[model samples]
Target: MSFDLGLQNTRALVTGGTKGTGAAIVDALANAGAQVIATARSIPADARKGVHFIAADVATSEGCAAVADGVLAAFGGVDIIVHVVGGSSAPGGGFAALNDEIWLRELNLNLMPAVRLDRALLPGMIAQGSGVIVHVTSIQRALPLPEATTAYAAAKAALSTYSKSLSKEVSPKGIRVVRVAPGWIETDAAVALAERLAEQARTDYDGGKKIIMDALGGIPLGRPAKPSEVADLIGFIVSPRAGAITGTEFVIDGGTIPTV
Candidate 1:
């Protein structure tokens, strides 16, 4: 199985790869012998081994151009691209509480990065005749919590639809486009967000988690998925083992989304 991965010397770019799930993905790819270029707004305090860090915010077109420039200049082009940059800091009062700026920020963070990156880098992939692209969306797109992430959910939903559409256009040209929807991933970001939620709900962290879980219909696994688990999945999807897999949305939500 490991041999089938065939990731040795593969060139990869992971957006938002400094911390949380992004860091995990970078580690997984690096461990598999891929040359990983990880991009984020800033450098991480504890960086991963054998992964090159490039500072950039993928949410902006300028940042997207910077990434594409760095990749092209360094490696000519990346063989695999995993988009892992996105989040919501909008107030928890639902749509009415969100202003235009917040909504636009959410869209820029969650949606435009993927769109802009693809537009800039896909030509190189097509020219090379093979590549892999993974867009990390969210379960919120499907099982939305409007009070907390209405704009974020909307943005991710757009990302998912865009990924599906792009996959059909590129798969035949030897480029694979896949979307991954992860729910409640265990990360430092998740912990910090939980702390805020705990404060707002006037409960302890565990109690706040319970409240959040209850609203989501509960994770049957009784816990969020580890970032490494999702990273491993992303690693596999981009590897030769999943070469036939394309244009699909894989949900690693710990069964939080109970839909079939």
Candidate 2:
């Protein structure tokens, strides 16, 4: 049996689509026959087929406007928006280690981009009276790791809450807003961190990865998730088949979160 999402001709804008989970989401949407407009700070040299690449930094209001304007001009209007542009620049150290500047940066990186994009594009979606918005949050919102990412956790918590509230207001108006929270995805960053930990601890990269997983209390599935796995869930949530699902968060963590 085939899992047909029936998203042909749908136009989607995926932020941070240059790499990692965002790239995977773009691929999934394209595979489902959606016309994908992917934005990032830089476009990859060997870009995927069936997806248009736009260069813009979503962390700034000007960048968000440029991307929205570009997409509107190219596609006329967008039917789906997947906000996957967020990360913590905070280095290791607890809350006190993060000063005011760092806190502001974290908030902007992890929260404001989505806010600005929604502000810019929601009017178009509202005018159409139908659309889907997916915000990629982190599992840190529920399981915060204060050792290095207190601000990141806080910002994602705010993003999740904002998504829920936004969904409530817009679901009655024919737009769906949802959140996806992923944990310890095995992306390029994860590999690099593991290698760095290995160098610091005088161990192999695989050994360092084991330490990291152990620190996460051991993933029940005995592994971190691939970016593609998270993308699969994203594709489902934004598809018409999931029309009844809105205003909620789906956690894809390989059972690492240890909660209901």
Regions of model 2 farther than 4 Å from truth: none
Model 1 earns a TM-score of 0.94
Against the hidden reference, what TM-scores do the models get? 0.94, 0.96
lDDT of 1 by residue, 1-260 (tens): 23657899999999989889998999999988999999998896788867878888787899999989998888888899999999988998877999999999999999999999999999999999999999999999998898879999999999999999999999999999999999988798878877888999899998777776788889998888899999999999999889899999999988998878
The lDDT per prediction is: 0.91, 0.91
* Model 1 alpha-carbon miss at residue 84, Å: 0.5
Number of the top TM-score candidate: 2
